[model samples]
Target: MIKGKGYLKFSKSKNKIYVYLFGRLTGEEKKKNLFAFGRLENALENMYQIRESDRLPAELSELGFNFDDLDEWILALETRTTRNNKKINLPVIEERCFEDVTNYDLLGMSEKEVKSLNKDETFKMYSDLLEMIFGALAHIEELEEIEEG
Candidate 1:
């Protein structure tokens, strides 16, 4: 029942879904898993395209998630609740936006060009730019606090 904007690896065992975020299993106790994508469109396309036929077990077909909306699936996971009052462990969407912006190529553009392109009229580009700005700001604040301490 994991959702959000990135790649997720999952499997169903004993009527439960075991989700892995950013290539690491849930048992690892990692706080966050970074995704590399320039825009939310790219991220959503990758996330929603996952079908139950991909990696799910035969028993999971009866679960509601097989036909549920992506957002609903995410919500269910976040609350750790199933439709039938069962508890399920799932991956969390640490951040709705991609984390590793540098990992994506801006179509062979230079740094300056990339910055300029971010000002384009496309809504997707603007959204990505905003997310990147906030993420950078948070990182800077964390670094400053670490240095001060």
Candidate 2:
């Protein structure tokens, strides 16, 4: 299942997380991020050389995401969209937000121009580039809040 359809599902989900985090899309549109997390757990299990844990802060930290952000990002995937009644929001994340996703190819795309794109297009470009940058593993996933806590 991790070959074709599974790959498609992971790609779509990775896009959802990126788009949702960027504040360009409605919370209603973000789907669950659990599938990616599950696959990660499986892959880690296979990596017998390295130990694994349900709390993902260490693994995610290695990816350069801050500890505090991990909880909120997971919520965007696995739990309610809003923290309270208010919308979960973000500043416009550009190449600065991620070291791995941005590249020389995007050096000419102004941050303003990028922020102006519609959510669908923004997500597409972000996910497409991320897939290119980190390949399929970028979509692997993180720990859910409860799982981490």
Candidate 3:
């Protein structure tokens, strides 16, 4: 298990990955039962919308915390989480030579906006975002250096 942020864990084969609040909302500093928002995106989004006292820190990273930009990191996080949760794999041309992939909009994007995007546009967006994540992870060990230094 890859641990982060108190008791949060990410596994190479993690299924039903959740984001939970750990730590204190009250003035006391004892353990509190975790409140899971079911998914990281839901937790992060709601954590921002709700009072800070209602939750603990929900940063994108816990170890080292070397994020440069929150928004970019969030997009990368969402892309990674969504793809992982969906188990997205490289499209095999023969597997879909005669079938059409289902059309679906992003979870929170407005339907009108999604409707304006064609399959190519959606795929391009996914490709670019995922590439950004891969690039970022390539330098992930830098955060460890920051921590040790």
Best by lDDT: 3
As a whole number from 0 to 100, the lDDT of residue 11 in candidate 1 is 45
- Model 1: lDDT to the true structure: 0.39
Alpha carbon lDDT of each predicted model: 0.39, 0.36, 0.40
**Clashing pairs in model 2, backbone N/Cα/C closer than 3 A:** none
TM-score of each: 0.22, 0.26, 0.26
lDDT of 1 by residue, 15-109 (tens): 32345334233344443443231232243333334432354333233222343444444333334455456655332222222233464465344
> Between prediction 1 and prediction 2, which has the larger lDDT?
1
The sequence of per-residue lDDT tens digits that candidate 2 reaches over residues 1-149 is: 01111111232233232221221122344333322344322332322222233344454444344434444444433322444444433223343334344443464565565546675665456555544543323334333334666
Clashing pairs in 1: none
Q: Rank the candidates by lDDT, best first.
A: 3, 1, 2
Clashing pairs in 3: none
Q: What's the CA RMSD for each of the models?
A: 17.4, 15.7, 13.4
